[model samples]
Each structure stands twice: as C-alpha cells, then as structure tokens.
Target chain A: MRVLGVDPGLTRCGLGVVDGAPGRPLRMAAVGVVRTAADDGVGARLVAIERGIEAWLDEHRPEAVAVERVFSQHNVRTVMGTAQASAVAILCASRRGLPVHLHTPSEVKAAVTGSGRADKAQVGAMVTRLLRLDAPPKPADAADALALAICHIWRGTATGRLQQAVAAHAHPRG
Target chain B: MRVLGVDPGLTRCGLGVVDGAPGRPLRMAAVGVVRTAADDGVGARLVAIERGIEAWLDEHRPEAVAVERVFSQHNVRTVMGTAQASAVAILCASRRGLPVHLHTPSEVKAAVTGSGRADKAQVGAMVTRLLRLDAPPKPADAADALALAICHIWRGTATGRLQQAVAAHAHPRG
Candidate 1:
C-alpha cells in the first residue's frame, strides 16, 4: 500500500510518502515539509498548510494517509498548534474519501526500532537503514514522518480496539 | 456586516450567525450545533465538521467568520479536540478568503456584558437583550457562539496587537 504520513506542526509540517506492503521492501516516494511563517496569523498559516497538503495529495495520490497523533506535552501551547495542524491534514485526506489513520509516537518508534522508548537518533537510524537511504531524512521531523508511514504500513488497518483507544485519547467521556 | 460564529468542539460544534453593523442592532441569522458521534474517528469527525461549517457558509453567506479561541483547559484531551475542531472552522473560512477572527472567552463575555469575567448566564442574558430575542439561545455553546459574533462585531478587525496576542497564545516562541 502507498501511504502518506504527516507529522503535523504549525511552523513545520513534515510530509512523507511511502510505497510498500506488509512484507515487501519499502520505497520512499516523496518526503518534504510544509512550513509557515511563525508570525503569520493562525488562519493564514492553516490555509497555507491546507494548500501544501492538498498539493502533496494531488501529487502522490496515496491510498492511505497516516498522521502522527499529537499528545499533550510539557508545552501546552505547542500541543495546540500540533493538534490544529493535524486537523488540517486529516480534513484534506478525509475530504478526498481517502482512509486516514493515526499512529502514536511510541507506536512508530516500536515499529521501526523494536522499542517503544527509542530516542530520535535511534528511530532516525532505523528509518534510514530500513529505507536504504544514503542518510537519515533531515530536520528530524521528516524522518519521523517516514517512520509514521512505515509504521502504518506494517500495522495495516486499525482494529476496533485501536479505534476505541483513539477515541479514548481524544474524548474525556469515551 | 454578517458574521458566522463558531464555538468549536468535537461532540457538539456550535454555529451561530449574526447580521449587523457597528451602530445598528444585530439580527440572529441562524443558530445551531453540528453534533458528531463520540465513537467516530477524529478524521471522520473533522470531515463532518468541515461539511457542516461549509453548509452554514453556503446558506448564510456571512461576510466574516468568528471562532472562539481554544485555551488549555483542565481536561487536556477535550482541549485537543477543541483545537482541532476550531482549526477545521478556520480552514473552511480562510479557504473561501473570508476574513477570520478569533475571540477569547473573556473577550466575548466582555463584548456582550460589562465585564470580562461574566458567567454563562450573564452572557446569555446580554445576548438575548442585544439581539432583541424573546428568549436566550438554548445550550451554552450556542449562546457563546452568538457572543463570539457579537464580540467580533464590537471589536472590529483584529488589530496588530490582537493578532500578536493570538500568535502568542498558539505558538510557544511567539
């Protein structure tokens, strides 16, 4: 399956496309970032992101899209931006009738590195080795995006329990 | 000027439309909520919100849009959903090149009532009075959405200072 993974952020949204099956060798189709000026209004930045994501979707035409699930981190403000950016990516994919899936950071790390607690460098190294690239993708965010796609490819479809877990993460009453 | 106010949430997204200029009394164009099932995935929920907001835009043709600014509340999960839902609203409005503005909870309360710390009942009472409605809008979310539209009308365009405040709220380094 061809999958597009998006590591969403207001300032720099990472985009990566990958072609692979569960047991087949993976190929990197495209990888990049959608950046917005920090000084721009949230609305304007979101519009730019939408345009960028739409452009990538038009170009790659991936069968499925994977987005990094955002979590509440130490930085509350940054988390909000991440959530908003992820929303834009999800909106673009779902609007196109494409299947959208979200994988948590640890899930991606475990898929790539065999350890849920793997650090950035470890995940980056695994992604490079698995993709057979000259070097790891730049800006860490790009590598993370590829890892998300890879993770999604390995996991295949989300099960009912996984969907419930997602709901529980986003909804207090879930 | 007509304004569409969006009080964004995952479970129940409140949408309120108002028509008025600075000096004239405001008219209630429409008021409703776009309800989504909690069991649905976030992507599907976001798509539903985008469709609902787009339908409102098509039916009301508001000149501008106002969305309630999401803040870091005690419930982290709920906050993420709010930010995502609000982003969908902002995306829909800005994609159409409509002027989009963000109003904080206090700002909306202050615009409709005398103080920024006004509670829900107080704001609802003032909205009913300002809109000359026989009764206040049901559901606090709907009432708050109307208050947001009223706030944007009263505050006019987001000044340079206000935009900066918005940036500061959303971005960690801003």
Candidate 2:
C-alpha cells in the first residue's frame, strides 16, 4: 500500500509518500516540504498548505494518508497553528475519499526505530537505511514525514484489519 | 457588512450570520449548529465540517467570516478538536476569497455584554437583544457564534481600517 505521511506545521509542512507494506521493501515515491511565510495571514497560509497537499495528492495518489496528531504543547500558539495545518491535510485527504490515519510522534518513532524515545538523528538514519537511500531526506521534517508513512504502513494496516475483525464479530452475516 | 461567525467545536460547531455596520441595528441572517457524531473518525468529522461551512458560505455569502480563536484549555483533546474545526471554517472562507477574522472569547463577551468576563447567560441575553430575536438562540454555541459576528461587525471593521492606515503609511503610493 502507498501511504502519504504529513508532518503538519504552519511554517513548514513535511510530506512524504512511501510504497510498501509490513515486512516488505519500502520505496520513497516523493518527499518535500510546503513552506508558508510567517508574515502571511493564517487563512492564507492554510490555503497555501491546502493547495500544496492537493498537488501532492494529485501527483503521488497514495492509497492512504497519515497525519501527525497534534498533541498539547507549551506554546499554545504554535500548537494551534500545527493543529490547523493538520486539519487542512486531513480535509484534503477526506475530500478525495482517502482513508486518513493519525499517528502520534512516539508511535512513529517506535515503528521506525523500535524505540519510542528515539531522537531525530536516530530516526533519520534508520529511515535512510530502511529505504536504502544514500542519505537521509533533507530537513528533519522530511525524514519525520517518511517515518510517519513507514509507521502507518507497518501499523495502520494491522489496526484496520483488527477493527474489521471486531466489527465482523459484533455483527456476523448469516 | 455581512459576517458569518463560527464557534468551532468537534461535536457541535455553531454558525451564525449577521448583517449590519458598527452603529447600525444588526440583523440575523442565519444561525445553527453543524453536528458531528463523537464516534466518527477525525477525518470524517473534519470533512463534515468542511461541507457544512461550504454550504453556509454558499448560502449566506457573507462579506467576511469570523471564527473563534481557540484558547488554551485544560483539556488538550477538546482544544485540539476546536482548533481543527476553526481551521476548516477559515479554509472555506479563504477558498471563497472572503476575509476571515478570528475573535477571542473575551473579545466577543466584551463586545456583546460590555464585560470581557461576562458569563454565557449575559452574552446570550445581549445577543438576543442586539439581534432582536424572539428568544435567545437555543444552544449556547449558537449564541456565542452570533456574539462573534457582532464582535467582528463592531470591532473587526475598525481594526481592518487601522491596519490599512498602518500599511499605507509604511508604504506610501506616491
């Protein structure tokens, strides 16, 4: 399955598409950052991010989209902006009828590096090795995005199947 | 000017449209809540909100859209949902090239009830009186939405003009 992961932010939104499944060789379809200036109005910045995500969705056409869930931060303003950007990414995917998954930072870290407390450098290095790339994706955000995609591919599919199993058990067909 | 105000929330997003200038009698054009099921996925909830906001914008065609600025709350999840919903409102307005304004709770309370710390009852009473409604809007969210629109009508226009003045002074055309 191809999954597009989004590291949502107001100033720089990271996006990466990965094609693969659990226990398989994963490949990077695309990776980039969508940047919005600090001076731009919040609405305008959101619009720009929306357009950028729309373009990526059109270009890569990933089967599922994974977005980083915005958790509470000390900086309320920053968290608000990040949450806003995250919502825009989810909206883009929903408009296209794509299933969207949200993964916490710790979840992505654990999935990629086998450690929830892994640092950025460790995660980046593991992503490079896993994708068999010469170097890690430029900008920490890009690497984080790739990690998210990988994590969702590894975890989301299993979770979906489990949910389906539960549903089927609850309402069995005759 | 006509303004559409949004009181962003996950379960019940309040939307209201009001028409008038700062000193004139304001008229209510529309008021309602966009409800989403709590059990729904976040992406589906956001998509529903987007569609609701789009419909409001298309029907009301307000000159500007006003959204409640999300404030830091003790409940992180609740705040995140509110911020996400607020972003959808802004995005809908931005897509339509309509100006978007964000008003704080204090700002709305002050504009509607003459006190920033006024309680919901006070604000609701003031909104009913200001809009000349037969009764206060059913839900508190709806009343808050109307208050936001009134606040923007009374304050946002003046703020916009002041911003224009500052910009023109910073960069003179001649």
Candidate 3:
C-alpha cells in the first residue's frame, strides 16, 4: 500500500508519500509542500490549498493517507488557523476515497524516536536515518510529514501490534 | 465600508458581501458560493476556491472580511475536515491585506437575535428583517455568512461600546 502523510499549516503544508508492503521496506515516493502567501484571505488561500492537494493526488495515487491531528494550543487564533489547516488535509484524503489516519503529535514523536516528548529536530534526525535519506528533509513541515509516514509504516506493520492497538483504542469512533 | 463574510465548508463555501457605509443603507454587493467536488484532491479544490475568492474580491473590493470561528466538536473527523475549509478562508483574506475578523457561533447568533442560543431559522429570519431583504438568505450557509458579517459590523461600531469594553478588558495587554 502507498501511504501519504501530511502536516498542514496556513503558510505551508508538508507532504510525504511512501510505499509499504509486507516484508519490504517502505520506499519513498514523493515529498514536497503546498504554500500560500500570509496576506491572502481565507477563501483565496483555501483555493491554493485545494489545488495543491489535487495536483499531488493526481501525481501519486496513494492508497492510504495519514495526517497529524490538531492539538489544542494556548493561542485561540493560532489554534483556529491550525484547525483549518487540519481540515484541508482531512478533506483532501476523504475526497480521494482514501482512508485517513490521524496521529497526535505525541504519538508521532514517540514513533519517530523512543520518547513521546521528542522535539522536532530529534524526530527529523530519526526520520532521516530510518528513511536512509542523505540529508534531513528541508523545512520542519516536510520532516514532520515524513515522520508521520514513518510512524504509520511502523504502526501498521505486524510488529507494531502494540502501538496500533493503543492508537485504535484512542480512536474508538473515528 | 464594504465587508465580506464567509462560511467555509469542505464542499461549498458560503459568501456574502455588504456595503455598510454611514449614509448608505447596507447594500448586498453579491452573495454566492465557491464549490469543489469531493472527488477532487486538496490542490484542485483549493484552486477552485482561490479562483472563486479572487473573482469575488475583484468584483467587490471589501475593506474588511469576517469569518465564523469553528470550535471543537465531538466528531474529530468532521472537525478536521471543516478546519481545512476555514484555513482557506483565513489565508485568502490575509493575502489581500484585508483586516480579518472572526466571530464565534454564539456571538453571531446573539448579534442577530438578541440571544446566543438562537436557532439557524431564527437567525436567518432576523437577518432578513434587519437587512429588509425580500426573503431569508436562500441557503442556511448564506444566511450564516451574512449573520457573521452583521455581527462584525454591529460589534465594530460605536453602538458596540459595551462589547468593545468587554473586549478591551479581556485583552488588557492589547
């Protein structure tokens, strides 16, 4: 199965795609971003995002999608913005008829590293090493997205039954 | 000043623009929707949204834009999808140098119906009567968008002194 992972943001969206098969290593398919100017209105910015997602979907036909869930933040304004970005990722996945899996920040961090409290840099370093990439992905968003994909690959595997069980329990109804 | 109100959704975004100057009665410059198919990916949907917003902005250069702020919902999946649509609205407004205002559902309800617990029909009825429109805005989303704009106009005016005072107190540092 091909899995696409996304980290959504108002200014930029990080995307990564990987092919996963039983007993085979997850192969990198694509990695990139969709961006819009900070000055655009909500309507216009959405257009840019939708278009970016459509193009990416067309290019790489992923069988499944995983997106980072929106975590609660202290700032209401930022939270609202992040929520909107989260919606875009979900919308994109659903529209394509691909089952979407949402991972919390802590879960992604734990999967990338050994600790749930791992920082972005630590997660990035781990992702680079695991994916056998020459260098860490550029822009924190992309690295995070790649990490999300890696997390899913590991969690979706038979060896990851413990983690998958916990994740499934967390999403009782989703 | 002309202000545009938007209610963003995964498949459709409701929009309404009103010219609210001192002497001029509120004029409905335009009201419509920007739509995208569920089958389309994020990028394609965003393009359609962007084009729609651009057309609206180009036709009616509203000075300010108002959008409804989405709060947490029980359904994580639904909230995630809606968030993307909201981001599109916010980004589009920001890009055009429009001073964006966000209105909570209760705030808009209260502004229109003198009560925060008003139903959609009640809010729609009041909006139609307040604006002296021939009928309630066709779709529920349209009325909601108009209500959002009205809430901003009502809250941003001299008559909204109480609200302004409350806002100031809420954010004393600002």
Candidate 4:
C-alpha cells in the first residue's frame, strides 16, 4: 500500500511517501519538508502548511496517511504548534476519505530501529538500509517522516487488520 | 463588528457570536454547542466540528473569529483533543480570510469580569449581564463561549487596531 507519513510541525513539517505492505520490500516514492517562516503569523503559517500538504496529497494520492501523535513537551507553545499541524494533516486525509493513522514517537522508533529509545542517528541508519538508499534523507525531520511511513506499513496495517477481525467476530454473518 | 467565539472540545464544542464594538453595547447573535458522540473516531469528530464551524461562519459571516487558547492540562489526551479542535476552528477562519484571535482563559475572564481569577459562575453571570439576557446560557461551556465573544469585542478589536496603526506607522507610503 502507498502510505504518506507526516511529521507535523509549524516551522518545518516533514512529508514522506512510501509504497509497501507487511512482509514486502519498501520503496520510497517521495520525501520533502513543508517549511514556513518563523516570523510569519500563525494563521499564515498554518495556511502554508495546509497548502503544502494538499499539494503532496494531490501528487502522491497515498492509500493511507500516518501522522506523528503530539505528545507533552516542556514547551507548551511547541506542542500546540505540532498538534495544530498534525490536525491539518489528519483533516486533509479525512476530507479525501483516506484512513489516517497516528503513531507515537516511541512507536515509530521501535518499529523502525527495533528500539523504542533509538536516537535520530539510529533511525536514519535503519531507514537508509531498509529503503536501500545510498544516503539517508536530508534533514532529521525528513528521515523521521520516512520512519513514520515505514512504521505504519509494518505495524499500523497489522493493527488495523486485527481490529477489523475483532469487529467482524463480534458481528458475524455479513 | 461581529465576532464568532469558539470553545474547542472533542465531545462538545461551544460556539457563540456577538455583534458590537469595544465601547458600545454588545448583542448576542447566536449561541450553541456542536456535539459529537464519544464513540466516534477522531477524524469523524474533527469533521463534525469543521462542518459546524463552517455553518456558523456562513450564517453569521462574522468580521472576526476568536478562539480560547488551549492550556496545558494534567490529561495529555484531553489537551491533545482540545488543541486539535482549536486548530480546526482556526483553520476554518483562516481559509475564509477572516482574522482569528486567540485569548487566554485569564484574559477572557479579565475582559468580562473585574478579575482574571473569576470562576465559571462569575463568568456566566457577567455574560448574562453583558448580553442583557433573562437567564445565563445553558451549560457552562456555552456561557464560556458567550463570555469569549464578549471579551473579544471588548479587547481584541482595540488590540487589532493598535497593531494596524503600528504597521501603518512603520510603512507610511502605503
């Protein structure tokens, strides 16, 4: 399945698209960052991010969208901006009727590097080897986005199937 | 000026609209809550909120949109949900090219009542008195929404004008 992963942030949002499924070799379709000036107004920054995500969606048309779930941070303003950007990504996917998955940072790390405590270097190294790229994606955020897409393909798909099975078992005879 | 106030939440989002300026008497144009089932998916809940806010904007065509700034809470999940909903409200207003204002809880309270530490009952009472309504708006959320509207009319307008003046002063050619 084609999946688009978004590492949501107001200053620099990471966008990556990967085509793969469970037990299949992953391929990178695209990777980039949506950036907004720090000096821009909040509304304008959000609009820029929205337009960037929409452009990516239109070009790639991924089957599913994966977003990094916002977690508590020492800086409330930072977390709020991340959450707002994350919401924009989810909103775009939902508007297009595509299923959106939210994976925590630890979850993505564990899925990509087999260690929940893996650092940025470990994630970048693992992503490079998995995608068979000569070099890791530029900027840590882009690599993180790729890791999120890989995680969704490796873990989110399985979890989704399991939930479907449970629901079917509860109401059979379809 | 007409202002739309939004108290963003997952289950029940409060919406209120008011018409007036800083010194003139304010009139309540609309007040209500947009609710979604707790069992609903996050995407569905967000879409419901987006539609509700859009409908209100379309009907009232408010001159500005004011949202309650989300504050950090002990519950991470609750805060994330509030931030997400708040983003949707901001997105709707931004898309329509309307100016969006965010007011802190204390700021809203101070604008409505004499004290920033005013409790819910105090804020509700002040809202009732300001709108000249026979009774306070039902549900604490709705009253809070009305208070937000009233506060924006009383404070945001002046702040906006001051910003404009500063901008004009910096660039006199325009």
Using lDDT, give the best candidate's number. Answer: 2
Question: If the candidates were sorted by their DockQ against the true structure, best first, what order would they fall in?
Answer: 2, 4, 1, 3
**Which portions of model 1 show Cα errors greater than 4 Å?**
A157-174, B157-174
TM-score of every model?
Answer: 0.89, 0.95, 0.61, 0.95
* Weakest ten-residue segment in model 4 chain A by summed lDDT: A68-77
Task: Score candidate 1 by TM-score against the native.
Answer: 0.89
Of the two candidates 1 and 2, the one with more favorable lDDT, higher being better, is: 2
Q: Which 10 consecutive residues of model 2 chain B have the lowest summed lDDT?
A: B69-78
Give the alpha carbon lDDT tens digit for every residue of A23-134 in model 4.
Answer: 9899999999999999987888888899999999999999999999888665888998999999889988898888999999999999999999999999999999999999
Clashing pairs in 1: none
Task: State the TM-score for model 3.
Answer: 0.61
Deviating ranges (above 4 Å) for candidate 3: A1-6, A9-79, A86-128, A131-143, A149-174, B22-24, B159-174
Which candidate number would show the highest DockQ if scored against the true structure? 2
Once model 2 is optimally superposed onto the true structure by TM-score, how far is the C-alpha of residue B113 displaced, in angstroms?
A: 0.8
**lDDT by residue (tens digit), candidate 1, B55-78:** 999999999999988887548789
- Residue B122 lDDT in candidate 2: 97
Candidate 2 structure quality by residue, lDDT tens digits, A1-174: 999999999999999999998878999999999999999999999999999999999999999999998887668878889999999999999988899989999999999999999999999999999999999998999999999999999999899889999999998992
TM-score of chain A of 2: 0.95
Candidate 2 to truth, TM: 0.95
What number of clashing residue pairs does each candidate have, in the order they appear? Answer: 0, 0, 39, 0
